[model samples]
Target: MLILKQLILGLLLPAVVGGGIFIFAKSLAWKKESEQKKARLSGWLVAVALSAGYTVGYTGLEGLPPFPPREGVHWLCYLSIIGLISGAFWHSSRWGRLIVQIALSIVIPRLLLNSAFKYTWGQFEGIIWWMCLAVAVFIFWHIVQESFTILPAGGSSPFVYFGLSGGTALVLAVSGSLRLAQHAGILVAIFAASWVITFVRQRSDNNKWQVFPLGASPVVALLLLGIWMNGYFYEEVPAASAILLAIALFLAPVGRIEKIQRLGARRSAIVQICVIALPVVIAIGIAVARSGLFGESSSY
Candidate 1:
């Protein structure tokens, strides 16, 4: 009975919430009153299934041999639930909507992992890793897309929010665990700066061609600043690189004036950043804690 309760609460909530949202969205798309909107929604759903679903499925399918049955089952459940929520949010371009999606898809899983990390060996893989990879890819693609166009010369796309929130959470964890609060706090502050600058630039629609200071080019400059900081402290390949690349790609393509402006509408800053950062940070924290810092394996 206790096992049943734990299973229902731990696994069922996500499955139901994620599946319910997706089904509801599909239902709305199919309704006659919203056919036009529905059509667009349908197209996005298909695209998401293709893009997000393909990643989830590929990771499971390709990584099957070594994965245990219990682990595989857990991953399938997580992947399906996450994909559903992400697909729902990715369907819209609004910041609020995207934030909700990221909360459901990325934040929940991270919380779960954190909890497990405290209680047990707390290791997880399968869908969690795939979702991280998928979200990272999605953010990178948008960063590159926005860099040449919609973003002002040194401005970043809205994806920096994830860097701020997720990166801060990561710093907090490492700080608490490794007794590196000063260093972690500094990194978190830098991430916040990146988010603020990116948000302002996004709101203003700035697109100048010169490298501004940290605030001037928050997306590119701040991200690089964060990456440099992380690389200095943490030996892990800084997951913040996606945002940094987006910054560089945009700056490099600024010379193609006509090509840059045509990049079209951008995604919200909050959702994209959360999607990109949350999973990677969670994975890194867990992997580091369990595997031991500096690449040494735990005797346990």
Candidate 2:
């Protein structure tokens, strides 16, 4: 019953609330349209809707946040608010967005890894680990947002993330922490909401993403990174699985070539999702085999 409730509330709440926000935003005449068309042109709206859904669904699942946030996972709530504000206002300037991205890179790794740095590792080790992670976050965020601009219209980005979240959830479930898995699962719901909305709304639009809702990129990226960081460092996820899962979303843009684009919107999205599925499927299979979910010994 508890599992069913989590699935029910976790799945439905984010989808319903986030879907409502998307619909509302879609209805508004934000401004003039160019000769070329785009779908969900307002990135901040995407960020707002997804972030709001995450915050609300998180509350529903875990109840209210305690003062000072006793758990590091709880920090996502506050960081998301920060991400939303930064994403919403900085949509117009490229350099403005880059600055925000760099600042977050510096903060989030240490933010989630303070105790690990101070108590678990030596100074040199901590600095080395922090530098690599910060750099990776910066690069990943840059690629995803850039993809939003370059990739042909088809809502492929949301589809990629939806698949990524589902893969992460399954991997986390088999990694000895259902708690962490549920966190990833919340993201699954949020992206699923976006996936449906984007796929529907972009049926005719095929312009380059000008004034696109690129804001959702960082929010989605941060959630995935934070989940993996917490799961591996603080929970039971293996280092190998963590590495594999972290790079999974990087394959998202591989299917954006001219050939795939000519396949049309729906088919193009399918190709992109399939490309992303390579890493996700491998990670899930490895995680399941490692944990012996089917009652057999296996290797990671």
Candidate 3:
């Protein structure tokens, strides 16, 4: 019953709230001035939409966020607000976004992995793990953000993220932690909503360069990394499996390469997604086999 409720809260609630707000924003106008308004608000709006979905899901499943965040999930609620605030810098300038990215990279891993060091590991091991996670966060964010920028932008472009979110959700589920899986699934839902809105609104508009949330990629990337870290620390998820899942999302920008770009959007998208699926599939297989047979996963 809890899992079932998780689906509705994570999937249904976010789709309605986020998608509805975006649609309403479109209903306002298509004039240049109106578009200017959207341009300014678009990235922030994307952050808002994603945060709303995450916040409601967290609160519904876990209850309202408490002061100082006693639980890790509670920290996620606070992180959502942080993501939104930091995401605004994405629109400001590349330098501005990079600074925020660096800051978040340092912060998120420490927040999530502190429990591992405090409760299970020695200070040396903790420092090593924390450094690795922080590096991972910065590297992943830079790769995904830069690649998405180079990739052909269209209504349904950035498809790799949708795949990443769905695949992460699956791995999280099998690795143990229904709540984190659902949260990952909510990411899939939010992107699915974006695809629909982009298709409907972007197709007719002449301004393909309009201000979009593509700049706000860090929020989504860090959010996924955070969820994956939570699974690794709390659920005994295998290190290799977690590693593979993170690598999968980074492959999407390969479609934007000069050789691949010649193939056009449809063909390139197919090739890109195939590249992504390979790691995700292998990760899932490893998680399934080890958990079911070898029982070799590590945990705090």
Candidate 4:
């Protein structure tokens, strides 16, 4: 009974409410042209509604007259809801929407669900979990399906938003002690490659990315991952690490292609290096410090 209630409250409720807003936004977009404006409004509405309702439910509602409260696992569940709402609010483009839904569907739920597994079942249970990872894979496949459209230049592409979030997660992971962090780092690298592919496509058709939302995905990824992981990783990001992640995320694209010769584009290499390297260094430092590999705790 409790598990059923939780599933409804955590997954179904947000999907219904948030999905309704998305559908409405789609209708509005079809009627009008300025997708950005409509997207902004829809994003704001979804964010506010989800955040407010989540706060109320987690704090007051939950289990009728309310028992004491489930501890860590339940908190992750609630945070996943918050992350979903925030993702919807943060992204503007259609691709961004698709990527966010993928993250919400897979990353957020898995983080919480995995933690639940650790508590309920002994050990990390990777094999069984891998089987369960069908959920994340399904979400990823759907993201590819719903969002992929031919870029101006060549082939179909996954949304830039997915690349952004995945990249951010990888950067943060590079900065931590966990092996998952390294995998995240690799994913970011792959995503970066894909971003370059997109840039090439856009440039070929003379459509440069005029403005990029810099901090939204990375920041949100960190926040959501942090909350989901119970603050396990990236507790301390070095100044250099933070700067590098920022640069890598911020620049890199224009650096590769001279066609994108905007002011920001000019400094692409520097930014890209900083974005990729700074956070990684910081994360390593933190790991060493925590493990006392260096002196009595090196500040990451």
Candidate 5:
């Protein structure tokens, strides 16, 4: 019963709401280009709505306390909602977009650290970790955003990226923590449904493939947050293994490699898959070895 409720509230409701918004936005604009912008906005709406729905579904409305000391989930839900609103209006200005991304980069990592380690702001180690995480997230944001501009139309679709993310979520679920895995499952549903809507709308207009940060940001946040939780809170998964898995995800952009980029899309994708898989395999091996699932004598 709980699972059914979560599926309906977390997955079904958000998909309907997001799809409805996309269709309505399309109706409001007569021009194809204008409709594309609206579509992007609708994607942002889906990301925010999904985040909110997952929060409410997973942790009841009352689960979140007032403020000051917020949980990791609260930070994810609230920052995502606030960031979506700010991004919608501020996307036109370069500086505004940068400021918003930077704020989220700092806040998300700090919130995770607090939730996991319960470290005070005055602690030097905590501060250093926060700074490092913030920088890593900022770099990831830039990489994803840049991919939209760098990749040719239809070269690498958002669906592919989202699918990769979902796979990572599944991996985390199996090897790390079940609770975090559930959240990742919800995220997969959200992205999959939202991607379908965007793909259909683009097909109707014959538009080129493009993925805005609006759709990508929340997935990035969920992936990073899930990894952190698994590494710090879950005992089965080593912190180093989690970090390696997170780093492996970045290999999707292997097309950027000059030699690889020279290959056709089909070949490039194959290479990218190999690149991404190698590290994931290594991470999983490390986790299994560390866990001593096979035998006590196994070491690596």
Candidate 6:
């Protein structure tokens, strides 16, 4: 019953909010290319807003009030606001988009690392290790951003990615923190709902598919944060496996896969599914092995 409630709230509530934003954007005149661009930006802004509100509300419900030490939630809220504001300027200038990307790169890694160190590890050590992790996260974000940018506009690939994130959340829920998993589920629901409506409206208008930082940034950030928190703090998942899973998730954008790249969207999506599944299978196998060992040791 509790799971059902979380699923509905996590999925349904954000869907409504996202759907509303899509409707409003579609209702606009958008006669000029500039107007259409702004409309699309506005939709992303709404996505960020939904993400922030849902994060705050979800965490609060879990008895973690919006306060210090719960810095992860606060950082998410801050990122969403900054993303929405910065994203508004994205369509106006190249410098604006670059600024937003840089801001996210700086803030998100710091936030996730801080949360992991403070809440899970209890102290920040190994400066070189920390730097390496931060660098990896930044690179991963860049790859995801590039992936979204290159995907055929109006293509449903992004939605598929979002759905995969939700699946990741469910896996975490079973193996790690339920609260974090619920938050991830909510993020997926919001984005998925918004994407469907936006795809349909844009199809009707014949608008090219474009990527918005506001929507993609938080989703990726939240997913990485969840993985780190679950692996380090909860210790339900093995840290090495979690790190490998994170690395694998970002590998989908590697352009070296010539055979997969040549295929059409439908075939390409199938290839992506196969690529994503490989790491997930490995991670799950590691997790299961660890759990079995722990169980045997405990029985002793």
What TM-scores do the predictions have? 0.28, 0.86, 0.85, 0.35, 0.73, 0.72
Q: Which candidate, 2 or 6, has the higher TM-score?
A: 2
After superposing candidate 5 on the true structure, give the runs of residues whose Cα lies further than 4 Å from its correct spot.
15-70, 115-122, 151-156, 197-208, 213-219, 226-236, 288-300
Instruction: For model 4, state the Cα shift of residue 46 in Å.
Output: 13
Residue 166, model 1, lDDT: 42
Across residues 1-300, which tens digit of lDDT does each residue of candidate 6 receive?
876666555667656765565455445424436855655555465545455545543553454446453555445444445555554554566676666566665555556557565554534463554666656656766665565654445534456456556655645655656766666666676667667776776768777555343344544554455455444444465665576566655656543367777886657766775676577666655655665645641110
Best by TM-score: 2
Q: Quote the lDDT for 184 in model 5.
A: 58
* Displacement of the residue 281 alpha carbon in candidate 6, Å: 4.2
Better of 3 and 6 by TM-score: 3
Q: What 10-residue stretch in candidate 1 is worst by lDDT?
A: 209-218
**Residue pairs with backbone overlap in model 5:** none
Clashing pairs in 6: 153-209, 154-209
- What is each predicted model's overall lDDT from 0 to 1? 0.37, 0.74, 0.72, 0.40, 0.58, 0.56
Candidate 3, 1-300: lDDT as tens digits: 966787788787877786776565444423336644555566667667777766776766677888876656667777787877776666668687777788888888877766767888898988888788788899988776665565556543435566778877887777777778877877788777866776766667743533235545656776777788888877767778899988876777788688887898778867877887899888877877766646664341
Model 2's alpha-carbon lDDT is 0.74
Model 1 ranges with Cα > 4 A deviation: 1-35, 51-56, 59-81, 89-99, 105-109, 112-300
lDDT (0-100) at residue 261 of candidate 1?
38
Q: Which ranges in model 2 have alpha carbons more than 4 Å from their true place?
A: 29-41, 201-212, 256-269, 295-300
In Å, residue 155's CA in model 6 sits off its true spot by 4.7
How high a TM-score does candidate 5 get? 0.73
Ranked candidates (TM-score, high to low): 2, 3, 5, 6, 4, 1
* Worst 10 contiguous positions by lDDT, candidate 5: 53-62
Kindly give the number of clashing pairs for every candidate.
9, 2, 0, 9, 0, 2
- Residue ranges of candidate 3 with Cα displaced over 4 Å: 1-4, 25-30, 33-38, 155-158, 201-212, 293-300
